[model samples]
Target: MITTRDATKNDIDTLFDLILGIAKFHNQEEYVLTNKEEMLNSGFNNEPKFGAIIADFNSKVAGYLSYTWNYSIWNGCEYMNLDDLFVWEEFRGQKVGLMLMEHAKNICKEKNISLIRWEVEKDNVKAIEFYNRLGAKITEKGIFRWHLNASN
Candidate 1:
């Protein structure tokens, strides 16, 4: 059976491991530099920057969904940005991802959030199909980024 709950500070190590697992799956493990201490501080500090929902299978960590809030200037509305959604390889096809998404949707319902947004790699066809199955529309808009350094 799969269950999910809000992640706490004590789960930081496991969370970090799962994060690394996801990064490795995407072949971007080298890009992950955040340590457990940083994750703990950032997620559990006085002003938390993000929130996570952990999925467990038979009392073991199976997956997680991390999210943050953002506002749309043009729409004058707030939305939840799903930063990460990952399930362990062994846990695939078990509905764990669906459960996490439903959990997120419930959170949005309670918060009156009209939309949920997320980005998936263009090559991740499975992920795109999953999101499409959940009724998410793929926007034609392109994403552009400008990286900045703290020194600047």
Candidate 2:
């Protein structure tokens, strides 16, 4: 059976491993620079920058959903931005991802947040389908980013 709950400081190492698993799945492990210490500091600090929900299967860490709150100027309201949602390869197809998403939705509902946003790689057809099944729509806007310290 799978259960979901908010992540705590004790789960940082497992969270780091899952994060690397996500990077590996995306073939971008070489670009992952953050370490467990950094994750712990950023996630468990006095003022956390993000929040996470963990999916546990038989007392083992099986998956996680990390997110942050963002303000939409156009909407003039706060929304939840899902940063990452990942389930271990061994646990896929068991509705773990759906459970995580539902957990996120519950959090938003409790906080009176009406919108949730996330981005998935274009080629990840399975993930895209999953999101579509959850009633998410693909927007036409393209994401752009500028690296500030590429030399580092």
Candidate 3:
């Protein structure tokens, strides 16, 4: 029996663990600078910077996802930007990812958001297939993209 629910303050440590797992999966572990305390403060605040959900399988924590809302000027509306969707290695084929996504979609619907968006690593074939199965279309990336850090 799998269940999904909004993440609470108590889940901060678990969330941090799951997030680190995801970062490692993507070879981005060094980028996980946010600590558990920071996650608890921002994630559970009255106005959360992002929304998080936990996936449980028979009372055991299986996985988690974090997302935020983004405004699209071309679409003239806000869309749910699924920042991260990850399932534990042991829970991969158990449909935990599907359950997490369905939970996100339901939340989006409730908020009157008709679209959900996210970018997948191009080499993640399994994820691309999964998103394709969910009717997500690929959009081409701009030829030039840049990020601003402390140093130029």
Residues 87-115 of candidate 1: C-alpha lDDT, one tens digit per residue: 99999989999999999999999999989
> After superposition, which runs of candidate 2 have C-alpha atoms over 4 Å from their true positions?
150-152
Task: Tell me each candidate's TM-score.
Answer: 0.94, 0.94, 0.93
- For residues 60-91, write the lDDT of model 3, one tens digit per residue: 99999899989999999999999899998988
Supply candidate 1's per-residue lDDT for 138: 91
Could you tell me which 10 consecutive residues in candidate 3 have the lowest summed lDDT?
A: 139-148
Q: What is the lDDT of residue 127 in candidate 1?
A: 93
Question: lDDT value for candidate 3?
Answer: 0.91
Please identify model 3 stretches exceeding 4 Å from their true place.
Answer: 142-152
- Name the Cα RMSD for model 2: 1.7
